[model samples]
Target: MKFPRRRRDPVEVNLTPLIDVVFLLLIFFMVSTTFETRQALELELPESAAGTALEASPVTLVVTERGRYRLGERELGAAELGEALSAEADQARLHGLVVEADARAVHADVVRALDQAGALGVRQVRIATRETQATSTQAETP
Candidate 1:
């Protein structure tokens, strides 16, 4: 003999509330999110809160101890430096020059680089300097 058939209740999950909550959260994050873009140089940058950010990329001129200017890897004389800097500034579309002079470099060499930038009509000339890092021994001694 077969037993009487029993009626089963169907189980259901309501997804409308869950979808609405998820959509609201996604919209909130999209509206409230902020983005920032920052570009940085690898060399040690001097600490200064008063410095102005250059609108154009800068050409770097490294002054050696022997009073020579190095643009990238090429060493140039004071006279040659001016021409090269002007050409680079034009080609690179840069409006600034950064003279990274070594501590032992001659004062005249640094001045000459500055003059070159000025002659090229580069208005944003800036000097890059790094804060002196105390040696481990020096720090320990104190």
Candidate 2:
């Protein structure tokens, strides 16, 4: 009797399951992640009775008690504020402006900065303020 040789089978890899798992992970990250726009500088804003938070990031203009105006951290005079804002607008896609005025600063100064921002084509403008803290650090001092 003659013995016959057995044929060998070829090996193969299935990638359907691996591709499905990768797509599931991508969808999970896209749905669960939140993105925030942070300002370059930290600021201590004054309190206000009618202050609201914005959903989008805005260019910040800080007005000190000494009547100095600043765009982010750079100080600008009234005459140059518009030019500075325009220069910044060239680099930004969405334009919004927020004026953070000190409690002791004059209202006219804040208005002037808003006007300058508007002149630079910033359609959305807002004023910045801090929420009142409930901690009793001499609440009756004022």
Candidate 3:
């Protein structure tokens, strides 16, 4: 008995699902990307009506309510604060300095940090503050 041979059809890849997956990934990435960038710090920053986010990452100096200083994650003594800031200022690509002070922090402590930054010749210094809520019933005419 002789057996009959059957011709095979050409193999084809369907790209509709692949194209759908690529578009879904593109949409996910676009939705997940953050446009406004700022370093996170654990502090109850004072509220203001005119606080804006910083575009460039600046050297962050956090001043606690108890007059302690933290610079980019390093805790320093009052004397060491100046030294650390000076070293940061010496860096070739130092963008700027940001002072994040607790709302209840002593005024002098924040001023002292500012004084140190100024003494180190840091030109661009920004004080961080949270945005004030607009629910205030009392309006001040300016």
Best by lDDT: 3
Task: Predict model 3's lDDT versus the native.
Answer: 0.83
What is the lDDT of every predicted structure here?
A: 0.69, 0.72, 0.83
Candidate 3 residue lDDT tens string, 26-45: 99999999763325545798
- CA lDDT, candidate 2, residue 41: 33
**Total clashing residue pairs per candidate?**
0, 0, 0
lDDT of 2 by residue, 36-130 (tens): 42354344578866767775455677887667777755787778777777877743327566677887887787888777766666777777788
Q: Look at candidate 2 and give me any clashing residue pairs.
A: none
lDDT for position 96 in model 2: 63
Q: Residues 57-96, candidate 1, lDDT per residue (tens digit)?
A: 4467877777777785567887788678867877434545
Candidate ranking under TM-score, highest first, comes to 3, 2, 1
Lowest lDDT 10-residue stretch of candidate 3: 34-43
Candidate 1 global TM-score: 0.51
By lDDT rank, best first, the candidates go 3, 2, 1
Clashes of 1: 0
